[model samples]
Target: MKLKIINSDKILYEEDVFYLKAPGLNGYFQILENHTSFISILKKGNLKFKNKKKIKKNLNIEKGILKVNKNFIIILL
Candidate 1:
């Protein structure tokens, strides 16, 4: 799936990921290929994802918003 992470300064990350895990307001949640669409508020925590190479990556983020739809995800911080 296509994933993009952006902040007020610049775009942090943009790539294709096999899986994504983010810090939801209540807890943590994950997204995978063709996942159902939804939007959620995020909390201060780590955002994780697995690249096409199956390598796991992590990004520390503050409060943000997450939107997912049609195999695409956008993270605004």
Candidate 2:
């Protein structure tokens, strides 16, 4: 899956990720390729993902909005 992280200034990161772990409003959830489209609010926490070969990495973030569609994902923090 492709992920993009943006803040008030500019885009922070953009890359292909195997999967992503995010803190949802109610709980935490994982996003993978072909996952259903949805939107949610996030809390202060780490946003984790994997590279093409499945190497995991993480981005620490504060409150933000998350959106996912069939083609791509956009994360605004």
Instruction: Name the top TM-score candidate.
Output: 1
Query: What is the C-alpha lDDT profile of model 1 across 1-77, one tens digit per residue?
Result: 99999999999999999999999989999998999999999999999999988889999988999999999999999
Candidate 2 global TM-score: 0.93
Clashing pairs for model 2 are: none
Residue 3: error of model 2 in Å?
Answer: 0.5
- Candidate 1 residues lying further than 4 Å off, grouped into runs, are none
**Candidate 1 TM-score to native:** 0.96
RMSD of 1: 0.6
Once superposed on the true structure, which residue ranges of model 2 sit more than 4 Å away at CA? none
Clashes of each: 0, 0
Report the C-alpha displacement of residue 71, candidate 1, in angstroms: 0.3
Tens digits of lDDT, candidate 2, 1-77: 78999999999989988889998888889998999999999998889888888688988888999999994789999
